[model samples]
Target: MLRAQDLMTENVIAVTKDTEVRELALILTENKISGVPVIDGTGKLIGVVTESDLIFQNKKVHIPTAVAILDAFFFLESPEKMEQEMKKMSGVTVGDIYAPEVISVQKDTPLDELATLMAEKNIHTLPVLDKEELVGVIGKSDIIRTIAEGR
Candidate 1:
């Protein structure tokens, strides 16, 4: 079975928290990639920034419904969700909108497990880690290409 180290792209393209949204968009477009890993000053993986994050900027905000009863208010939806959406829509840098909870794989992870992780998490890109260091990245395209080659 192929491992993450065998299939992951070693030449990863990453950005810092301070990366501008416009710059991130440009990087994604130029590389034809859907997402990139975000690293800190020491090159440790901190989070991920993806096309979905960028698309959030253009998404319409759904206001939370609320009911006022006797001077008290009840929200049917999560107001925090709306606030987060608004922040993303108005974000200027990756730090403002990037997903901090990163789902990553280790070099020895089997391809099947990797595939399952991606599918279950609904993630298109995953950073490959060696301890706390970012070593590579795996994208959906990489899996497709590997399958095409019968690897």
Candidate 2:
């Protein structure tokens, strides 16, 4: 049976917690990855950062203006106007966006279970660990390729 070790990428590209968001963004773009595991000085997995998190980081909350009344004429209007909201979403750090609670799978975990976990959680990537130490990462593409290999 296929296991996490069989589908994981051993040479995983990880980043430190102190890594700047701009540089991390470049890393993600250059590697064409959806997310990366955040490690500390001792290489312990502490968090996970995804592209969705970065894209929506520090997004300004929109507020509705007022209630709208039906016009007697053919004119129309929408109630949830956002012209008054200020653009206060310029700066944010990875620490501000990263998910501190990470769910990792052990190397011995079965591939079928991994697939189920990924599908159920709607996650494309998961860290693989061996006794709390990051050994690799299993991405959706990796699982697909592994299945394609007739394993």
Candidate 3:
């Protein structure tokens, strides 16, 4: 069975947290990619920045509903969710909007498992790691190609 190492793109295009959002947009446009991994100064994967995150900047924010009960205020919706949306809308750098809770996979992970994870999580890009080291990246396109190739 094909594994993440067999399908992942070794020459990954990654960015640092300090990378400007504008530059990231340009990279994605030019490379025709949906997302890129964010790394630290030591080249450790930190997060991921995606087209969806960039689009969030232009989306309308949904305010959390609240009600005043006596002297206390009760939020009908998650205020933290609203705050996160607001931050993403006003973000200027990859660090400001990148998803830190990364959904990554190991190099030896089976393609079937990878596909299931991507489908269930609605993820377009997944980073592959080898013993805590970034090895490659797998995108939705790669999976599609694999399917087309009947692999």
What digit string (tens of lDDT, one per residue) describes model 3 on residues 34-129?
Answer: 999999999899998999999989997787889999999999998888888888899999999999999999999999999999999999989999
Residue-level lDDT of model 1, residues 1-151, one tens digit each, is 8999999999999999999999999999999999999999999899999999999899877889999999999999988888888998999999989999999999999999999999999999999999878999999999999999998
| Candidate models: Cα lDDT each | 0.95, 0.79, 0.94
lDDT-superior candidate, 1 or 2: 1
Better of 2 and 3 by lDDT: 3
Q: Model 3: runs farther than 4 Å from truth? A: none
Candidate 2: the clashing residue pairs are: none
lDDT of 2 by residue, 21-83 (tens): 888899989998888998888899998888877676556665544444684333233332333
lDDT of 3: 0.94
Q: Using TM-score as the measure, what is the rank order of every candidate, best first?
A: 1, 3, 2
Clashes of each: 0, 0, 0
Q: Best by TM-score, which number? A: 1
Which consecutive 10 residues in model 3 have the weakest lDDT in total?
56-65
Rank order (by lDDT, best first): 1, 3, 2
